[model samples]
Target: MTAARTPLYEEHVRLGAQMTNFGGWVMPLQYSTIREEHHAVREAVGLFDLSHMGELRIGDETLVQRVLSRDVTRLRPGRIQYAVLCNDAGGIIDDVLVYAMPDRGYLLVVNAGNQDGDFDWIRKHAQAADAARNVGREWALIGVQGPRAVDLVQRLTPSDLASVKYYAFVDGTVADVSCVISRTGYTGEDGFELFCGNADAVRLWRALLEEGRSDGIRPAGLGARDTLRLEAGMRLYGNDMDAQTNPLEAGLDWTLNLEKDFIGRDAIMTSRQRGLARQLVGFKMLDRSIPRHGYRIVSDGEGVGTVTSGNVSFTLGYNIGMAYVPPAMSEPGTRLGVDIRGAAAPAEVVPLPFYKRPHPK
Candidate 1:
């Protein structure tokens, strides 16, 4: 079967991006270099095509509650909430962002690879009166990330950008195209994600690039995006957690609202009662070696766990990673070793988010 291509496929090729298949979609892996694009997002601004992500519109509050891990009804219009979709077994199906639209409806932005599965899961549980629409293919999502993102995006829209606080959104016209602009991003930076129709994607992308030319806005790709998110300590669905991993062990307790009865609450409670066997923790390499997925983690000269996500933080110039280890060995300041290619490399557990952006005055 042939892989699908996003609306920005031709545009990426024209811009000389190196393309690769991601979640069955042909996407840009890098434009120039991963390090350069990664630094651009940290120092200036970077544009990303997140059109591959799935968007679902669910109108029923009761149905939303049953499918989400958080209190979706508590979110007022124009706000956004981060939550996870759990299976009956209490394992995560996907980590999603819920947007409370001005129309009193909810928009869910889900993982690209899990789009079909998530849709099927939601539909199967949805009541006959409940309505859920797959809007992923109908809209293109553009992520403008960094400190300068707001300034550049504000120029193209009449909406008061500053009025839209973090995790909030507004409906407005951007460069003559109607869109939903949200003050949210995955790179742990102050940025805006513009949701526009597929027909206007190229135009909006080019317009943002032209408007932000002086601000060092570069077209970034998946490679830089992965590194940026890893530096921020964000969990990737397939790697960090899956159907077998629960929220409590993945360090995502904040996203779970067990007070409200949702799917998997019982299983989650069961896991809590049984005690967590392991927990996800962040670490920095003490030796000159890079960590990779599936690398064995050793504590006291015995295999304790394995690395889920690992990378050399281009911005920090240090090798950092996250691994699932026994809860006893997951605390900060704990010493451990990563078996990199059969050689044990010393590492130390550290607080998550190896990189943190400076707060604006």
Candidate 2:
């Protein structure tokens, strides 16, 4: 395949992984069975190879609030914010989290597939504003996620991991490598994403594995990653959203600060004022079938839309998917039909986040 392989490629190979291409990278799809791996993360802890994700550091004291569509003037240093990088039309170019480090710098972690594109977009906007220069190829991303992820990570670092809050991170070290451990993850459970120099990835990975062995934390692959994120109700970039859809229609208006003059502000306003033609909603299959993407979505007798994302909820023991449909049909308790294979499969519009957090919300 044309995808790049991570440093952990040999490790995954030794562990007998089913490799697959994801975002231009040859990564592991699953180490064991997807369901077993999925439950491992939900019940305990799991390690993930996230080196393919893009890492960009911002250069400017005011760069944090300046670069993103959101106004982060009040954002403090040593913190992180989940924000969307939008186009001039307000359509999401990519969704990323900004880590405001204490050195008057901000670190941006973007999706692997959108790595180069995200950097280019940010640079264009920053160049137009004559602000925010991107410091390129500086760090590597390593994600250690699961229920006991914190427990395993704390043993490696000298500082207390308890201090880090959800969506927040701090400068720290793992196995003597300079790293930034962020208390964030895509999986439903609590976890951390570490930013370290490229040379130290192997050391960090080995150290984490050594510490997590007894805790049932295995080297999780991309297969578990998908099932885990799907259960969390988090939107996958290209699958759940794209250029044709805006944040408002994707059920992510809360991420946008309409009060500010964002890049896509006008387009969002126009779309809202005109009212949305379609809405994104979650559904549960009433039959024993997996709702794959591109499956036809129908209500009554006609096809309304196509499924953007679909999966069997590993934690909930049900097949689920997200699809765009008429606003009138986007309500809980509404009945719909998913065309699984060539047959119409009965389905229902259930509340989003079909899988619940073990801990109270």
Clashes of 2: 2
Q: In TM-score terms, which candidate is top?
A: 1
User: TM-scores for all candidates?
Assistant: 0.98, 0.94
* lDDT, candidates in the order shown: 0.92, 0.80
Each candidate's number of clashing pairs is 0, 2
Q: Per-residue lDDT for 1-361 in model 1, tens only?
A: 6888888889999999999988878899999999999999999999999999999999888888999999987899999999999999999999999998778889999998999899889999888634888999999999999989988998889999989999999999888889999998889889999999999999999999999899999999999999999999999999999999999999999998999999999999999999999999999999879999899998667889999999999888899999999999988999989998777899999999888899841
True-vs-predicted CA distance for residue 333, candidate 2, Å: 1.1
Q: What is candidate 1's local distance difference test score? A: 0.92
Model 1 TM-score, all chains together: 0.98
Q: Per-residue lDDT for 297-336 in model 2, tens only?
A: 9766689987888988888888888888888989988888
- Model 2 TM-score is 0.94
Stretches > 4 Å off in candidate 1: none
